[model samples]
Each structure stands twice: as C-alpha cells, then as structure tokens.
Target: MNMPNYFELFDLPVQLPVDVSLLTANYQQLQRQYHPDNFATANDNDKMVMVQKSAMINDGYHTLKNPIKAAEHLLSLKGFDAATEQNIIHDADFLMEQFVLREKLEDIESQDDFVILDDFHSEVFARQHDVYKQLLEFINKQDWEAALNQIFKIRYLTRLIEQIEKLQEKQYAL
Candidate 1:
C-alpha cells in the first residue's frame, strides 16, 4: 500500500501557515472513513489495515497541527536533518537570555510577590508569540539557522510557561 505524506494525506500544501479549519474538516472526514468501528464486521486483515490507517491519520494531524513538529517535518522534507542538528543553537545572546530566564524560574519560590510572577508570565508569553512569528518567517524563507534559533527559544519559553503554571498551582494549593 502506498502511504501519502502528512500534507498529501490532508490535501494541503507542504508548507507552514496551514489553514487549521480546513485541516480539521479534512481530518474529520478521514477519521470517519477509517474509524475502526466502520470495519468491525470486516475480515481481520481489513480491520488491521483500518487500525493502521487511523493511527497514521491521527499522527499526521498532530504533526501538522503543531508548529514545531510541522517545521521539523518540512525541514526534513527539504533535506535538513533537524533532529541531528538540533543541539547547535548558534545565537549566544539568546542562550544568555535563556540562562537568565531559567535563573528567574529557579528563583520563583523565593519571590513572594505574585505581581512579579504575573509580570514574568506576561513577558514570557509575549516573547513566545514574537518567537513564533519569527519562526514562521524563517520557515517561509527556508532559513534554517534563524528558524532553529527561534525554535529553541520557543521550546524554552514553553517549558518556562509550564513551570510558571506549576508554581501557580502550588500557590493556589497553599
């Protein structure tokens, strides 16, 4: 059996800035067609095939849905090995900023000021949005270096956001 790529499976162009609504609609249609329930009475082989198809469809949807994963997939298609090259973030300034951000996150427990936490969260959120926009631009240009830098920043910001949420949960539990 021939396997269509994620973009082909979704009937979309293999690029960034996808139409999410259209993706959702296409995914829903594909899911309905391949849902295991539809093959309940079929032969074991047919049921197994349906199960695999469903898994592929779900994986495709999620991979395309997330900007980071989508970017990595696109890079791979363009002959760039993102997974192997991921460790080299060439922006020293950005690395320093990340270090500072991590330090602030570590200090969160000692800082009793909720306002400070709120401000930090807002700052990180804004930075995350900015990085995402920058990432899109880099992806559009196929500028691997810039895109990788932004991806690193976005990942760090995401982790920081998760940490912030955990801290908030702890505060609320008090």
Candidate 2:
C-alpha cells in the first residue's frame, strides 16, 4: 500500500524544526477529511479504512510535534538506523559529566533544605537546554550518532526533573 510520508501528509517540508502553525492547520484539515463520523453511514469496510487513516494522521501529527521524535523520523527517512543499544555514547568526558549530574540528583534526597532542591532543578533545566542546543547542531550536520547521544542526555535530564518534582511534592505534603 502507498503511504504518504509524514512531511507529505502534513504538507510540510521534509526538514527539522517544522513550522508548527502550518502543521496544526494541515492536521485539522486532515482530521476533518478523514473523521470516522463523516463515514458513519458507510459500509463496515469503508468505516474501518477511515478509522485506520485517521489513526495514521494522528500518529503523524504527534511524531512531528515533538522535536526528538521529529529528528528520529527524519533520520529514519534518510536511512539511518538508530541502533541505540549498539550505539553507546563513546565521549568519555560527556559520560563523566553525566555521571556527576546523576550523582547530584541521587544525593538530593539527603539534603534537608528545599532551597537546594530548587537550585538543583534549575541547574538540570539549564543542562537540558544545553543538550537541546547541541542536538540542533548535530541534526543540522546530519550527524545521527551525535544527535542520538544528545537525545539520550535529554531523556535522562527529563527523568531527573520528574524525580525532583516528585520529591518536591512529597516535601510539600509533609
């Protein structure tokens, strides 16, 4: 079966950092066109087809919405396989930095001062932003390995932030 590429489906240029306004407009238009309710009176086979098409459109919209997902999709379209398990980050310095950050996050629970936790959260956010900047550079150069490494860093930072937030909630409940 012939399937439209996500960029083509959304009438977007096949590139990173897509125009979000155009994507949202095109997504809404596609939803309206393929909405199953519009085919309520059709036969079961046609309804099923519409449901599948709607699902595909929704999936494309979501994938293009998130930066990391969009980068991965672009890489896949360019024939890059993200062998994440095999493609370990080899930058020893970066890994050491990550180790230090993780150690700080793990030690947060031992601190009694809420101010320290707040400062740590801000620090992690700044680091995450730095990772995002690095990711953009790698993506522009089509350096899939470096980009994936940055993606991994961002995911870790995201989880770290969530853990900090959960701790804050628990502290507030006390």
Candidate 3:
C-alpha cells in the first residue's frame, strides 16, 4: 500500500523549519480522530487500521518537529537516505575546529567557573545556528551533498552543547 510522507500526513510543507503551532493542532486533531478508543466499537480490522494510523500520525509529528530529523526526512524525500549514506566530511578546517572545541570542553569541566561554561554553550549554539542556516540554503538549492555536510556539523555542535550543559549541571550539584 502506498503511504504518504510525513509532510503530506501532517499537511505541511517539506522543509526544515516547520510551523510548530500548526503541527501541534494537526497532531491533536489526528489523535482525536484515530485514537484507539474511537475505534473500540468497530470491527477487528477497523480497530487495527485505526491503531496503525494513530501510530503514523505520532511518528510523523515527531519526525517533522525535530530540525535534524526533518532535514533528514527532506533528504529522504529527494531520494537520499541520509541515515545510510556514508557522507563523511573531510574538511580539515572543520575537523580542527571541532577538535579545539572538544579540548575547550574538557578544560571547562576541570574549572569551577560557570561563566566559562555559559560562554562555551553560547558559542556552540551560535555555530549550530549558522550551520542550520547553511543547511536550509543548501536544501533550497538542492545541494544534497553540502546539506548533508552541514547536518553533520549541526549534529556535532548539538553534541557539544549537550556536553557543556551536562558539565554545568555537574558543577551546580557541587
């Protein structure tokens, strides 16, 4: 059976930046329409179908809500399965920057200053934002290769931010 993509299921455009309010409204509407309780009085086959549709609605909502997942889904719609693609970025400058960031993160953990961690978090967030913009631009131009690279950078920056937050939490628990 042919199935609609997440964007189609949500009645949304296939883009990275999705409208959260609309997505939430549509998700609630679909949940009400397809919730398993609504099919309790139906036939066995009908109940099963409703359960499946409800699951699809939930999965579509989550995949479209997350920027990274949404970007990956967009690439998949373009015949590029990013999950399985081995698109390794070999840019030296990018690699060096990541390495330096990691070193700074390690050093921040040993220090007792919250300001350092805050600054690091802001830097990583800014870098992630920049990469996200580039990803959007590349997706708009159909430059899948570049978009994939930017996705990797965004993922790395996200990880760095998470790590910084963890360190900050650890320090706070002192």
- Please list the residue runs of candidate 3 whose C-alpha ends up more than 4 Å from where it truly belongs after superposition: 1-4
The TM-score-based order of candidates, best leading, equals 3, 1, 2
- Provide the lDDT at 57 for model 2: 97
lDDT of 3 by residue, 35-133 (tens): 999878999999888988998899988888888888998888887788888757778898899999999988888887899889989988988989899
In terms of lDDT, the best-performing candidate is: 3
Q: Model 1 over residues 137-162: C-alpha lDDT tens digits?
A: 99888897778777777877898898
TM-score: model 2 vs. ground truth: 0.87
Candidate 3 accuracy as TM-score: 0.93
Candidate lDDT values, in order: 0.83, 0.83, 0.87
lDDT score, candidate 2, position 116 = 86
The local lDDT score (0 to 100) that residue 77 gets in candidate 1 is: 69
1 or 3: which has the higher TM-score? 3
State which candidate has the highest TM-score: 3
Q: Where is model 2 more than 4 Å wrong at Cα?
A: 1-4, 83-87
lDDT of model 2 at position 91? 78
TM-score quality measure for candidate 1? 0.88
Find the 10 residues in a row with the least total lDDT in model 1: 79-88
